[model samples]
Target chain A: MQKLGDFKLPQFFNYPPYFTLQPVRETREKQVQLWKELILEYCRTQKIFVIGLEEEFPLFSNPEIERSLSHEAREAFVSALVSDGRAEWLDKGHRKCLILWHRIQDWAEIIINFVKENGLEDSVMTVEEIRSGIESRGTELHGLDRIILMRALKLLEHKGKLAIFKGTTADDEGVKFSI
Target chain B: MKEQLATFRSQLEEFARKHRNDIRKNPAFRSQFHEMCAKVGVDPLASNKGLWAELLGIGDFYYELGVQIVEICLATRPHNGGLINLQELCNLLRQKRKHDREAVSEDDCLRAISKLKVMGSGFEVITAGKKKLVRSVPTELKKDHNEILELAQAQGFVAVDEVERRLSWTLGRAIDALDTLLDEGLAMIDDGHEDGKRRYWFPCVSSISSVGADS
Candidate 1:
């Protein structure tokens, strides 16, 4: 019943054993699955894309229970996510991770839907416009990470569904949708 | 009338004089003879003729209880020839000394042997084992060893070494103590089945009713 920023946490999130990496295989597998779901759910709802091991992550620690996942447990859960292709290590040290609540393909589909719904099938827009434009308001695309949005745009571009071009300004990038 | 009383007194005095010498030789016989003389109002010093007969009869039952106690102690340790050994008896004496240290004495084996014989119920004295032979009461020793052996048997198939370890004694001492009981025919040693190990047990002791589980 615990809520963080409109996301309802599962009952097991408060379980102390959830913080400790279980030694038994079956129990650990279940623990890792639960962690994967929670991490994806929290990141998707809160628009949280990056998780730094050194930095405080709300899901990793429970101040009420005075229990925090150790560094090993954090790596294990994140590694499980990476193995499942839902998250990736941002650095070789794995100190930071980029959670992909929506995989690049899924993101591309969302972009296609957004463009079609807005009646802008042939129109061009900057990468930033797709993230925070009025048309994208109240949608999952709003305030999304630029890097993730760019990655999703590049995937669509590679598939010939859209074309990406550099804008005149240093910060802006343009995207052209074909369909 | 005075002459008749005088004649009767002389006859009783003659009987006392005849047995007096034999009675004096055996204190028990002398006491019985003295009592009989007193009943007939005879003078013991005056009668010396039937003294040996009177002494033998009294001596027969004098230590009858003592003999029975020795018999029970012998039954307890049957290995010993109706005599309880010093070392095994010392162990019992040691136990007794704990509660009453004053009970300790070199003469305890002899006294305990005599005490059991006097009690006269299911006991005997026996000399136990070829070496360190001494007097012991088997029935009492059975009761004593039963308390300790029951505890050892509770472990189920206790190793010979384990018994030695728990008693805080070396293998030799444990075997020596056990051998005393064996000489009494209360315990047996089984060997040669496998690995050449000897297991000691009391077939009659019945401390543990279940056997196959340990085997």
Candidate 2:
């Protein structure tokens, strides 16, 4: 029931060894998997689109035990995520990471459902509207990461579900749903 | 004297035939019967050809129990990194077979372990202090390793300072043993502490189970 800003942390977060990278092969494999699942779940619920390796991520530290992951440990964990395709390093030095908590195809499904529910199946709406408009408010789409949304939209476009075009203003960059 | 011995042997055979069901179904009775058979230099579970074997079918019984033992060992191997206490294993086995009529004794569990044909040098029962540990992995643990594991039985972990102070050993010896255990995946390290003392924890010897939704 430990809380990291309303996100319930797993019990192992309090374990000191969990903060350190395990040297044993089997133990390290299990530890890496737990970190991957925790990172993904945390980002999904907290709506965190990116993780900075050098920045203060709540899950990486436990104040009760005064334990924090070393820089190498943090990089190792995020590297595991990168290998799994659940996350990506945004830079060559591997500083910042883009968290893809949901797969691109899944985000596309959510967008299609939103279109159907809002009666915008054949309508044209700005890309910004899909992210910030009142129509998308109170849904997962609200305040969604621009990069992930754009990727999902591009995936939908390639599948012939939608089309992208320019408008009068950058804010009005339009996505036309032909569904 | 030979006639008296024949009388006693026939009596034992008769007794086994009458309580054959009880001997198989009850752990206490099974252990007592096993002791009696051992005392008389007769092993009903030794082979499947004789009258004692035909009457008790004890060979097959131990064989079936061995399969269940192997099943529990394999399933919980990850929990303790393939090393577990013998008593804990028996408790888990009994819990697993709660619906069955046959209650297993520790002696029966030992017999079951011996009965398993698949167990080669990789599997063995080793003594750690007063307790017996069932090791499913092939890792060869030294006496120093066992001593560390025994010391860790209380708190689930041992700091190097603690190991040094308690065992009256040099710091280098303690570190060498702990490092070997670490390399074997039998011990996990925790360098995070208030005083910055590095610790080595053994899940196999530690009684405190890790509590989490998905451990």
Per-residue lDDT of model 1, residues B1-215, tens digit only: 77866686566557546765554345455556556655656543332244533533322322332353343343333222233334544444444336532333333344344444455543444332232233333334644344335533443223467667775767776666666555554444443224445555442323221111111
Encode model 2's per-residue lDDT on B1-215: one tens digit a residue: 87877787888899999998998888889888888878777777777577877888888778777877777667655546778788877877777778887778888888777656344635678888878888878788888999998998877789988989999999999999999888777778887776787878776765422322123
Q: What is the lDDT of residue B143 in candidate 2?
A: 89
So what's the TM-score on candidate 2?
A: 0.78
Tell me the spans in candidate 2 whose CA falls farther than 4 Å from its real position. Answer: A1-15, A41-58, A61-67, A90-96, A109-144, A166-173, B1-25, B42-65, B75-79, B91-107, B117-121, B208-215
DockQ of candidate model 2:
0.46
Docking class of 1: incorrect
iRMSD per prediction, in order:
27.9, 2.2
Q: Candidate 2 has which clashing residue pairs, if any?
A: none
> Model 1 reproduces what portion of true contacts?
0.00
Best by DockQ: 2
* lDDT over C-alpha atoms for residue B164 of model 1: 73
Residues A49-117 of candidate 2 have per-residue lDDT tens digits of 989999988888899978898899889999998887788788999999988888778889999999999
Q: Write the per-residue lDDT of candidate 1 for residues A43-137, one digit (tens) a residue.
A: 88788999998899999887765667889989999999999989989899999998999887898899999999999999999998999989999
